[model samples]
Target: MKSLATLRAVSAPALAFVAGFMHAWAIASPLGGQPVWWLQLMALTLLVILLDRCRSATAAAWLGSLFATCSIGGSVWWLYISLHVYGGLSSAMAGLSVLGLSGFLAVYYALAGAVFCRLRPRGPAFRSCLFAAVWLAADLLRATLLTGFPWGVGGYAHIDGPFSALAPWVGVYGIGAAAAFVSALLAAVLVRPAQICGAWQPLLVVVLVVVALGRSHEAQDLERAPAVSVTLLQANIAQEQKFESATGVRDALEWYATQLMAASTALVVAPETAIPLLPDQLPAGYLEKLRSHFATGQRAALIGIPMGRIVEGYTNSVVGLGPGADEYRYDKHHLVPFGEFVPPLFRWFTRMIKIPLGDFESGAVGQSSFQWSGNRFAPNICYEDLFGEELAARFRDKAYAPTVLVNVSNIAWFGNTVAIDQHLQISRMRAREFERPMLRATNTGATAVIDRFGRVTDLLPRHTRGALVAQVQGSKLITAYAWWLSRLGLWPFWVLVAAVLTVAGRASRE
Candidate 1:
């Protein structure tokens, strides 16, 4: 009996670690394909099992923290490549930095576990609902506080699974909540048979969710325009040489200009910073020549260029260069910490690197989408596509909401890792949320067109220099997720969390 108890104790922690590690693997790409989503549910079930077995809130918190540490550490290990390879940080320091970030970020989940243990219900259904609500609150907080990093959330695992159908209706966090609820319900069924009767409520919620998704009007009877021809230029500019005036800058100018002048399409989009210079700073006659060429015809050129004068501060911006297009510019609203703009007191840390163009001003949020021949193009720069709520905010005014989405990125900083595929997942989620086609142009990779259903219809292989030519139809209908998020922000989610906890407390008392 003693040996049996010892074995149980040892296996629980081991399972916790395995669960976290498997969760990490489930979201990993090019290494673990999207179909490993089942592993995520299994991992969460194991974590819930561990939490349920713990005698105290503190123990549950520690277990949750351990699981999160393993998961996040595994998922973001590639950050070592970015910092050491590109940012010039020492390998030891870069590695320690990643470990430190994972440890710190895991606390959100730890807090959720701690809170759930303290106020858990005797009835498994209420407890499961409480767990789901608390888990979502943690995720929502992680994605909100300190500019938010919501990568590797469980909902992302469902990108190709049944939970995906909920994306257009509830967004990633909502999908994540549903996933957590289901995972906890599975744990309840396995660990505590007495509570099985409570399962019907969550099951009914699932039924309603499915019926709602089935009856969704987001994709029905929307105006479909004739496919527009788009040419995405992926110049494959090496990050180290992109700004050097000697060869890198000059070569990009010559190469991209040559391609643009040669192409005939309704819209021609270049990856972020393809111009590498502001409007007033372009080499003499270079900007004028491209403008002159694009002015004579129906073709329009939308390229990423730095915008603003020396005194006002420059923005990482994309400007429309051709005639009837020059007035429109989309400045990046979400600036990447350490990459675009160093956070307060972190300037000293940024000084350790040799990267250029690290300091940039932020653009106003909700700027008007660039109006193309009847279709509005909303542009988001690198890392901005990670925020679905920010993107959803643009849908409040449907009349002015973008019909097509455009994202331009320069992922060469991470260099030839799964970061490319992970970024592609982020874009696909956005495509589903708004039911809009995402047109992409990238400096290094993932240049493609995502249709309304978030499927990649056309793609250019990563680390290759090529242009992708494809036709895409615009979407006019706003999804249910977009409609709610644009108006309520994340208030509904917080309210749901509160309600679940309140009901769980009453059930436990009863």
Candidate 2:
């Protein structure tokens, strides 16, 4: 028989592996073209906490590091498919790049693990809360401090489930905290010596109550919004054809116009690069056609196209057409690293891989709002919506708050991978966090109208060319997340982290 110490040592790593696998599996299962299994994810997390309790600090730390590394590594695999199979990167190079990226991200997870082990509490309740706080702090650090990569947070896995309701109030970090809380609570229950079920029964009640309250709040919030009509057009253009052929642009614009003409929608939108023509170089005949259609009144158009000076290089922009077109020209601020503009160091590496629009420039910083039919529309083109702070900055002052959010994207670069779905989830959370309706127009897939509560009013399927029409509500009132906690619910969370660390330090000394 093995020594008790050996079993204890093995338990931590095994549990950590299970946790990492479950976290990755939960995230991938939904987006990997499989049915979502949330209960399984919860069980796995609980197992990790229980195992951590049995192991030494060193063993727990190692396990946590392993889990963190694997989780990030799995996500990098999806990113590889996006860059390689879809974005046209060389298969070998793309795989290598993604593995490298996964390795880099795994460092953050390792940090989280090391911290969790070092700060592991003596009391069960203290330990659980401390773990949640530390993990959230680590997640916040990951999203901030180096331009941030807020993708693949633990909370994102709960986007479509009952837990999603918490996003508006506490943002993504809150969801993660909730997940951690649940796992810790389960650990406490499972590891109990028995017959003490009555003592811990109140904890379960508290969890149920919190979840119930979250659901109730979501339902009420959903009912509050006054629906506004929106139409999103998706032109299923292939990646190779999008950047190369001018005819593809002409056809896409014509198709979108024809679709808009058939329906009497309030707002009509087309995806990024829907009109491949630059702003100053828009075809005269096409401009006239668009002008004539809007002259009839009561309709506005927002289409994504290439804009800015060719002398300084092109900027990926979303130009609002019709009356609003003259008032608002939203140039995308955040350019994709390798996709839009190449970093100086990586310039030499570009020869090994193929990247579309690898020579584009970034737009000016800060949010630009568009006024349309008695509403302020904020545009987040492509990857700009991923930056939570950037998105919240637009409505920092209530006077300049946008009535709705518009995201124009070309997700065709990622093909049919989970990246598209993951992108949609981020957008959904943003809408709920800001309590603003979001209209997403994309090339290829996931063209959708999202409500203030993050519910999808309507959506177009991936790889399909279609139009989605739905009534999206607009909000002027600032959400708690928008007015208070932008970007992983930062301020309060930081304060909490400081307090937790202080208490943990005192406990360690004692």
Candidate 3:
């Protein structure tokens, strides 16, 4: 009996780690395929079951933290490749950096677990709802605080699942919250057979949510603009040699210049930093020649190039060329931490790595979209699409809302990993949320056209040098997500979480 009890104690922490690992696979399976939504729900359900059995709030918190550390660490383990193999950080330092980030993010979940244990409600239904609310609050905080690295939220798992229908109405967080509630309910059923009589209420809520978000939220036809012929360039430059002037830089400049001059599409796009140097830094007449060619006729090109100098501030910017396209510039507003800008007290850390052009000036939030061929093209840099709320800001003005979403990225820093598949899914989520077709131009992979329905209509194979020439249709009508997120921001979700938690607290006291 003593040995059995000892075995139980050891198994709990191991089980938590396993649950978190499973959660990571559910987000973007490391096995290299689409996310399985059921797997994610089951993983969270297991965590909830474990939490319910914890004797103390502190114990639950520790278990939750361990689970989250494993989940987040497993999800973004590719960061180590960028840090050690590419950024020149030592293997030990790279491993610690990834662990540090994962642990820091796990704090949110730790708090949630503690709160759930402390405010344990009597009824299974109310208790499950409370757990869901607390989990969602943690997710919201993670997505908002510290520049928001919400890479592998639970909702991403459901992009191709049943709950995906909820995306246009409540967005990713809402879907995740619903999944949490269901996970807790499943846990309640297994862990609390005595509370089986109270299951109807939670089950009813789930039914209502499904009926409301799924049935009422059917896809309606949006105003369709004329199709635009776009040529998306994917140069597939190696991250190590991307900035080298003699090899990667020279080849990119020559190849892109040749392609730009030869393309007949109405809109032509190159991946981010396709020209890794400034205009003046080019070998003379390089910028002017392309501009002069695109200056006339209806054909236009949106090329990614850096602007400004070291003395002032350089920007990761895109310049539009062609008749009505010139004079149009869109600077990247959302910058990546460590890669684009070092955080406070992190200057020492950054100096140890070798990321070039690590610092950049940020652009305004409401920059105008590039207008060409009667379609407004909203541009987002690498990982910018991860924040759907920021993109919703443009929907504040229906007249000027982006007809097409354009993403230019160079995620070669992480090499050939699930990051490509994950990023493609992120872009697809944006396409689903805003009901706007997404056009992606990447340096290495997932260069494709996603329809407003979030389906990949055209795709170029990863790690290949090619151009994706396709006809893309732009949408005019806004999704419910765009409409509300633009008007009220994340306040609705904040209010939902607050109200649920308040009710749960009052019930616990009763």
Candidate 4:
């Protein structure tokens, strides 16, 4: 038989590699729009536990760090694609930029690994619980601490799966915690001998129960609400050529108007800044033509445009056309960090990068809803969709919340990169968590309609120019998560983490 030392040394690196590989696949698989990769993560967790059984504390720590770093590094490949291929950055600069970002994010995983090694448990049950707690804490920190970039949370892997039902109760963070719990249980089962009836069996049972509850919640009788037929116009206009000529703007506007001018639509939507020119700057005849086509009482058009005043500076505003122009304007609230407004510290860096009309001011927070065809819609422009709580809370204070959630975006900047797909996935999760149907109209791709349950009913392909028309249903009411935020998951997770830490401390002391 091999010595304990030999087994420990061999297993540690192997387990680390497995963890890295699993994370890589989990992130890549989703971006590629493939099948779920939760099994890969579970397998890696099992391998880690098995290695932990034979390894010393120092070896375990090293292996754990390796696992964490590699897992996060998986996203770096996509980051490279975004910067180099999509963002127009040079090959050398893109490589450097992605490496820097990946290294920074990987540090959180390294810390998780260190904590896991320090809390080495004697019992299989204790070890598994501790692993779940430590990893979850690290994941939470990654999302919360420094303006929180919760981009690749493990729970997102199950976005379309049975576990997605948990979104309404625990939000994405809760789903993430559940994923960690399941992974730990898998680890426990693999590490412990078949005779050991430890926490693994009970934990597996709990996971199943939670999943069943999620499935039931997903299936819970949803009342069929009145549907609103919307026409989403995807004008795949290139940003570089958007402002080159006034004729280009007129041609694009005419194209959208022609496609959506039919009588069946209650409201017609356009992508962000579809009208490249300012409201007043458009050709006088073209503006008149739009007014004549959409002015009738039967239909109203909501078009995204850049509207500005000398007093207010330039703003990315979505204007409602048709009957009353003054009554309906939804300015973009959460502007992108560097794309829309230059950060105070990085203001000087703007000289290096070339972006058209980069400095734009943000709209007032909690602005009034955009009114269209008797429906008050809560508008989320671009990156605002990523802030789940902020978007959900916008509807809470009012007696009657907006009936629909409209996201007007220009994903052309990222081209056909995974950025658009990842963005759509998050939008799907938000729909389930908020229980609101989301209508997205983007410049390049993924202009689609998402139902209240997070299902993508219909979507236009990326890089193609076309119109996607669908009937979308509004929310029945605000979901449980809309009010609770992450509280439903945070309290329970912290309690478990504290208990695990207590046990770990005692074990270390002994």
User: Highest TM-score among the candidates is held by which one?
Assistant: 3
> Number of the top candidate by lDDT?
3
Per-residue lDDT over 344-434 for candidate 1, one digit per residue giving the tens place of the 0 to 100 score: 8888889887677788999887888888777888999987998888877789998999899999999888788777777888788889878
Give the lowest summed-lDDT range of ten residues in model 1: 28-37
Estimate, for each residue in 1-510, the C-alpha lDDT of model 3 and write its tens digit. Answer: 999878977999999999999998897777874778999999999999889888899999999999999999988999999999989999999999999999999999999999999887867777878888889988899898988999988888888888888888888888899899888888887887766668867777787877777666564656998799999999998998999988899889999999998899999999899999977788889998998899898799888898998878899998888885347899999999989998998999999999999998899886899999989999989998998988899999999999999999999999899889889888888898888899999999889999987899999999999999999999898888999999998889889889988887787788
Error of 1 at 380 (Å): 0.4
lDDT of 4: 0.69
Compared to the true structure, candidate 1 yields what TM-score? 0.95
What lDDT does each candidate get? 0.84, 0.71, 0.89, 0.69
Question: Compared with the true structure, what per-residue lDDT tens digits does model 2 show for residues 285-400?
Answer: 87577766775678878878787657768878776665533545787887777777777787876655576556777666555687766678888888678776778877677777
Return the TM-score for each candidate structure: 0.95, 0.87, 0.97, 0.84
lDDT of 4 by residue, 166-283 (tens): 8887777677666666666666666566625775576767668777867767666664446778888887887555556755566677777677566368878888888777657667
Q: Report the lDDT of model 2 for residue 49.
A: 62
